[model samples]
Target chain A: MTVVGYRRPAPGINPDNNSSAYASTRARAPRHPAIRIEHTLSEITGPHFETGGASAIDLTRGARGEALGERIIVTGRVLDDDGRAIAGALIETWQANAAGRYAHESDQHDAPLDPNFAGAGRIISDSDGAYRLVTIKPGAYPWRNHPNAWRPQHIHFSVFGTGFAARLITQMYFPGDPLLAIDPIFQSVADPDARARLVAALQMDVTVAEYALGYRFDIVLRGRDATPPQE
Target chain B: MKTKLTSSQTVGPFFAPLLRGDLSQMVSAETRGERVVIEGRVLDGNGDPVPDAMIEIWQANAEGRYDHPEDMQEKRLDPAFHGFGRVGTNARGEFTIHTIVPGAVPAQSAQSQAIWQAPHLNLIVFARGLLTRLVTRIYFPGEIANDSDPVLCAVPAGRRATLIAKDIERLAADKAASRRLCFDIVLQGANETVFFDV
Candidate 1:
C-alpha cells in the first residue's frame, strides 16, 4: 500500500464518512491497494486540459447581480512536486454564500440564503498554473457533527492535476478562524505545519484597490520529490 | 524545491451539487462502446451507508485506447467517450455510472510485453470525513485476464475480489440494451475495498 510519491495524509482527513458513524473518525484503514502496483505510463501521464472552461469563476454575482457580503478574491498557482507550475489545471470550487449557507436542498442550517450567490465556480490555470476567483467571504455555519459546532468559513476545491494520480479534492480555510481550534475535521491532521497549508494567506498584491480583499493559496502535486515517511 | 507538499483537507459535505452539475455522465449519443451500467454504494466500517460521498471514474474507451494524447496506441478513439464520469451517493449510499465495457490495453512492462491488461476502470473516491481522495480500480468479473492483471495480481489473492465488480442481470426486459455490475466501496474494516496508492 506504499504510494511511491504520495505524502501520507496527516491523521483525521476522512476520504469517507457518514451520518450514523462515530462523530470522530475511527482508526485509519489499512494501506491502500493501488500502491501495490507500479504505475504504468498511463497512470503517470494525464489528460490534456485547455484554458477555457464552461463555468464562470466570479461567484460574487449569481443569476441576478452582486451577492451580499464582504467581497474577497482567492488566487493560487498549481505546482508539481518539483515546484514547477502546472499549466491548464482545472480548478472547481463550491462553498456557502456569504451567510455560510449552501445553495442546496440538503443544507438546513438556519442562516439566510443569498439569492444572488449560487456559490460555485470553475477556472482553468494559466500557463503559470495560476487561477483566480472573486466571491463573498463565506460565513461560519452550524453543523450536526458536534453540539453547538460551527464549521469555519471555507471553500471546497477540486484540483485536477496533470494526471488522474495527481487529482486532489480539499478545502481552503480563512486564517484566524476560531473554529479551526475545535473543529474535528481541521484538527484531524496531527501536524501544525501541515494544517497551516490548508489556510490561505492574505495577498495584498492580488487585492483589487478599493474592491475585494485577496488571498493566495498555492497547491503542489506529487512529483520527483520523495514523500516523507509516515510518523 | 525545499518546500513541502501541501497537506490535504476533507472535501466535506457540500460538493454534490457542483460535481453533479458538470461531470455526472460519461456517455453521450455519439459515444461508442458496449453500453453498461455500473452501480454500487459507499459503506463505512460499521456497514452503514455513506450518503454524501462522491465517486469519479476514468477508463479507456471500448477499444482499450485512452482519450488522451499520451496514449500513443493506434487503437481507435471514441470521440464521444470522454472516459470520465462523476456521481454522488444517494440516500441509500448508492451511485450508478453508465459507460462502455472498455477493451484491454497492452501491458507497459518490458517483461510482460506480450500480455494485455484486463479491462478495468480507474476510480477516485471523496467523502466528508476523508482528508484526501482514495484511488482504486474496478475490474470486470469472470475476466480470465484478471488472474494475470499486473495491478490485480498485486493485491493479495484472498482480497482481490474486493476490486472486481460483480456481474448482475439487468432487471429491464431489454437486457441487451445494457449490462450491469455492482461494486460497493467499503471505506474500512474487513471488506474494505482495495484502494491504490498510485
Candidate 2:
C-alpha cells in the first residue's frame, strides 16, 4: 500500500529560518540546505490529542479575579490549504500580561505581573475546525535584539493539524498596528500577502455585547493532494 | 487557495508555562520492548546551549505499529504505549525522555516494493530562534539495518552520524551500565545536525 503525501507550502509562504533581522537566527539557523525526502508513514502519522477534558479557553480570569487589561475574544478556523476544515486540531496560545510582562522567570521587564493573569491557554478546535479564546490584550515589550527594540503585542500560537507535516507555530498580530511595519519578526516573511495572513482582523460578529472585543485569525495547514500514490 | 497559510514564527522564550503536562514518558510499566533512556542538549551555531527549546518525538510501538489510523500494518498495539513524547529543554539546554526501542516497520513506497525500515524515532525541535520546527530522526547505533533504511540512506554519508545516538557509557570511557543514549542537536555551525525538509 502506498500513502499520499502532504503538499509542501509554496515558496515565500514560510519565513526563512536564517532571517538576519531576528538576531538569534544568526547563530541558530541551519546553514546547509535541508535534505529533501519523501513522506513515509512516520511523516504522515501524528499523535492524536484527546479532547475529552475541560480546555483552558478563558485566560482573563484566574484564581484571584479578572485580569488587568482589555478583554478580547479571539475566534478562528483551522483549515487546510485546500480550504477543508482540520477537525480536532490542538491550539496552544501564550502571551505576555497587559503590562508587557511574562509570568516566566527569564522575563525581567520592569512591569507588574498580574496575579490574575497566567498568560497561557489551550484548546482543541471543534469538528468544524473552529476555536475561540477569551483573554486579555497583550502589551508591547522591549527586547535586547537591538538598541531601543520593542516587540509588537502578539500571541504565540502552536497548532497541530491532521499529520506531523501539518504542525505549525506562529504569532498573531492585531490589524493596523504601526509596529507591524518595523517588527523584524513580523517582517521575516518576504511575501507581503503571506505576512498579512499573520495579522488578525477585527470581527464585530464575534464581539460580545458590552463585553470583549473580537478578532478573527484563520490558520491554513498543508493539505494532501487529491491523488494517492499507486499500490 | 482561498487563504495563504500563516507564516511560521519563533516559539519565543516564554512557552515553558504553556507546556506543563508530563509528556516525557511515552510508556508505562506494562509497556513492552527494551527500555531505553534518550538524553541530549540543544545547541546553537556558537555551540551555546539553547535553554528554551521543545522536543517532540513520535515513533512506533514495540510491535512496530503506530497509534495512528494511517498505519495498517498487521501488528499488535501496546495498550500501555502511546508512542509519543514531548519535553522542554531545561535551563541547561538538556532534555531526557524514557521510551522503549521501537520495532522496525515495513516500508511502503510508490513502487510497492517490500522493505523494512530501521527502528528510529521521528523528532521535531521548536525553539525561541527557530522560525520553523526542525525535523530530524534518531537512529540507534550499531543497527545493521541502518545501511538500507530508506530515510537514513537518503541522508549524505558524511552527515549521517548526526542522526545516530551515541552510548552514554562509551562517551564516559566506562563499562555500559544502563541503556542511555546521548544525541546532541546543533542548529548550525561546523557540527550542525542534519535536518530533513520532509
Candidate 3:
C-alpha cells in the first residue's frame, strides 16, 4: 500500500510566514540522548523460519508442498555503518507459497499446494554484501476488502541488524502492482511524494534461471554515523 | 563467531534508515473543532535533540481533577476536555501537544496538611527499545501549594522550576483570561528530566 507521511495536513494557523528566522530558531535546538541506539546483526536472538517455502509457483506440488519445484534464488547485499557493503547480516523473508497459502492456520486459501512449501526462506549476505533465498514467485490473493479485494505481489523481509535494536522490518513490492491505486492502506499516505519512497525498482533482469525471472531489491538497516561528534 | 572484523571486513553501503510505522496514520481527516497545537523541542543535558521518541501528556479537564473514579478531589470539570495526546518527534526530536490549561486540583490532604500542588500536566516519554520509560510532571507558576507538594520537593532544590511551565499572564490587551505554560524537558545525556527516572 502507498503511504505518505502525515497525510491530510491540518489547518496551519501560523502568521509567521515560512521565514528564515523561524527555520533557524528551530534548527538551533540540540538533541536528546535516548535516540542514540545502534545494533548489528549477530546480536538478534530470534530463530528464523520459512513457511510454505521451496514449493514451485507452478503448483505441481499439489495442495501440499511435497514435490520438488524449480530452484531459483534471491540474492542481496548489506550495508555497513559507514554506508559501505556489510558482509554478514542475515536477511529473512516469509510469504505465501506459490498457491498463495501460508503455513499459518488462519489462512483459508483453498488452492492445491505442496506441504513442503512453507512459503518462507532466509539468506545471509556473503562477503560482497550479497545474500540469496531459494523460492518461487508468490501469487496475488483476495482479501476481505471487497467481495474480492486482491493484494499485489509482495514479500515480507526482516534483516537482523547484527546487534541490539538494529533489526529492520519491511516489505519488498514488485515495481508494477496495478492494485496499488485502489488499495485503501497504500492510498492513505499523506504525502504522495514520500509514498513513492516505498516502491522498489527491478533490476538484473533478462534471465535469472531461464524459467525464473529476476528482480533485485536491496535494503539498508539503521546504523551509526562514522563521523565523530563536533565539539 | 567472528567477533573481530578487520578494516577490510567493514565494507557496507549507507542508506538512511526507514521508520516502520507512519505518523500520518495517526491523523484522521474527519474531526471538526478547534484543536490547539503545542509544539516544542526535546533536548539532552547538552541541549541535543532526540529523534524518534514519543511524548505523551495526560491532564484532567479544566476543572483540575482526573475523570477516573479513584479521584475524589474537588475541581470542576469542563465538558470541553481534550487533553490527552501523543506526538512522535521528527529527526530533530521536536514535539507538540494541543490542550487547554488545566485548573488546579484541590489538595486532598487533611486541613492540617493544607498542601496543594500547582495546576500541571503529566508527561511520559517512550523510546524504542528502552526497557524503562521517563516520567515527569509539568507545573504552572503561581501555585500556592508548590511549597508543600510532595513530588515537587522530591526533586533537588536547585532545579525546581525545570519541572514547571512558564505562565503567560495575558495573550492580548483586551483578550479573555488565558495563560500558556511552557515547559521544556531536558532529558538525561549530560542533562536529565528534572524529577523523573525510568
Give the per-residue lDDT of model 1 (tens digit) for B2-34. 455666667777786556455656788888878
In model 1, the clashing pairs are A13-B131, A14-B129, A14-B130, A14-B131, A15-B130, A33-B195, A34-B195, A34-B196, A34-B197, A35-B197
Give the top-scoring candidate (DockQ): 2
Per-residue CA lDDT of candidate 1, range A69-180, in tens?
Answer: 9999999888976788878888888999878899988899888998899888878888788888888999989888767878899988888876687777778899999989
Global lDDT of each candidate? 0.76, 0.88, 0.46
Pairs that clash in candidate 2:
none
For all candidates, state DockQ relative to the true structure: 0.41, 0.64, 0.02
Q: Which candidate number has the best TM-score? A: 2
* Winning model by lDDT: 2
Error of 3 at B191 (Å): 27
Which candidate, 1 or 2, would have the higher lDDT against the true structure?
A: 2
Task: Write model 2 residue lDDT over A1-231, tens digit each, in one string.
Answer: 577788888888788898889998898899998998888888888888886533338998789889999999999899988888878888888999999999999999999999999988878888888998999999999999899999999999999886787888999999988988999899888889989899999988989999989999998998885544432
**Candidate 2, after superposition: displacement of residue A113 in Å?**
0.3
Model 3 interface Cα RMSD in Å: 20.8
